[model samples]
Target: MEKNYFNLLQLPVVLPIDGSLLSLHYQQLQRQFHPDNYATAPDNEKAAILQQSASINAAYQTLKDPIKAAEYRLSLEGININEEQQTIHDSPFLMEQFMLREQLDDLEHAQNWDELTLFYDEMIERKNQIYAQLLEYINQSHWLMAKQQLYKLRYYAKLIEQIELLQEKQFNL
Candidate 1:
């Protein structure tokens, strides 16, 4: 299963890249090895099909998400960025996130739409900067660094969600 993930990551990791190619590949592979396809076969063959199907699903999931795709690549290089194993190497990013959260809390209490707009824009810019860093890490094959960038990207995405909620409140009022 792990080997299959490595193979899938080797393919382009974009959602729209070569449309229908991945789906076609997955379908062909599944048809040949899906557990149901081996229902009439021996027990050993059925077991093998189950194992292969599991691998296929795992590969499909990893290739579907850019962040996961990056992590899988890192894993191939002996780097594991699982949540429990991840280190906090980016203190500045953490500190910034803390400050942003504080400001968001204050804005929520004050109902300051204008300040929220400015903060949202700043956070969006920060997200773009992090994406640029992520690209650099990918280009350099710095999987660990890219994993850190992924953390920052997730944080920014969450912040965007919060900003959207604030905007909705503003619109409602």
Candidate 2:
């Protein structure tokens, strides 16, 4: 049986989880189950400790990021979010994405920090709005709506990363 990351991490299985508490639990688990502590154990026990350590690391990583945590939550509800196969057919949403991408492309070529900063702020606001919607959907068990919002969140996240990378490159130059 697959492990439920929330249960493993002693989390509440909710979106917008308490990140600080998650980290604390992860650290405590690591200290307790780290294979280094079992150095003198029998071979079978060492192997089991290794597996437990690996599971703790995996659970920590999955819960540390909101996107991954949300995806895991959906999976727990028997709803798989397959970005590759899911086609976002909402016309308004598609149009907004096209417009945002166009703006980002223009900003990338221009490399104007002022404009890029403004764009980044706008993207963050939009992403936050989507996140709020996603939170509500998840709380209400509106799985399909939450999935759709997650798709949009992925786009904004990538776009934000692009802006940050551009900023970093400019800083280096």
CA lDDT of 102 in candidate 2?
Answer: 93
The lDDT of each candidate is: 0.75, 0.88
Clashing pairs in 1: none
**Every candidate's CA RMSD:** 3.9, 1.2
Looking at model 1, report the run of 10 residues with the lowest lDDT sum: 10-19
Candidate 1, position 137, lDDT: 86
Stretches off by above 4 angstroms in model 2 are none
Q: How high is the lDDT of residue 33 in model 2?
A: 91
Q: Residues 69-123, candidate 1: write the lDDT tens digits.
A: 6566666667776768655678887898898899999998899999999989999
Task: Say which candidate scores most in TM-score.
Answer: 2
lDDT of 2 by residue, 82-153 (tens): 756887658898899889889888987887789999999999999899888988999999999889888888
Distance from true location, Cα of 99 in model 2, Å: 1.2
Measured by lDDT, the strongest candidate is 2
